[model samples]
Target: MSSGKYAFTKALKELRFHHCQTSPQSQAARSFLVRAYPTMKKHNPQTPILIREAQGIEPKVWARYGFGKERMESLAGLDEKAIESKVTEMATSEPQS
Candidate 1:
């Protein structure tokens, strides 16, 4: 029999499951994310990136795991550059694997 102590704990990072609509603005954001993805992968390669056409909606971030408490973050306020900056900032914060 094994000891009572826990085996291990793994960090379930909030995946970037982006829901983008079919529009000029959403398309732009999608392009920007596609470009920035490789850089993010260089750090957290396991980070899942999925894109789906969300009708009548602007580009937004939603949860893939955990309780649904965090508000849906709209990409409306951010341009392509802002998106790149945010991605870069997040990549830097993660510990290099």
Candidate 2:
């Protein structure tokens, strides 16, 4: 599945997004979801994209890969574009395991 400059790789199993609904640190994550979620979901129907919201929690993006491997990235202090780039990198790259 392709979105913008990134394509979803087969190595990726799932994507988990963590953010606060109304916190400054989470703004970019929320923006990323708003702008990219639909396209990503439409293109990669088989992949699970989970969004978790909580109060005061740090914003983050997680990529789960095969063999129980996973990667996490902090989203704090980033802009929407940066968040998108980070997510794309995570989604397309192979897991270290």
Candidate 1 lDDT over residue span 1-97, tens digit each: 1221111112324445364556765865787767755554455555565566776667765423334422235666678777655544443343233
Residue-pair clash count for candidate 1? 0
Residue-level lDDT of model 2, residues 1-97, one tens digit each, is: 2455556899999999999999988988898798888899888889999999999999998999998999999999999988888898898888885
The alpha-carbon lDDT assigned to residue 10 of candidate 2 equals: 95
lDDT of each: 0.51, 0.88
Worst 10 residues of 1 by lDDT: 1-10
Per-model TM-score, in order, reads: 0.56, 0.93
What TM-score does structure 1 among the candidates reach? 0.56
In terms of lDDT, model 2 sits at 0.88
Task: List runs of model 1 lying over 4 Å from the truth.
Answer: 1-12, 62-71, 89-97
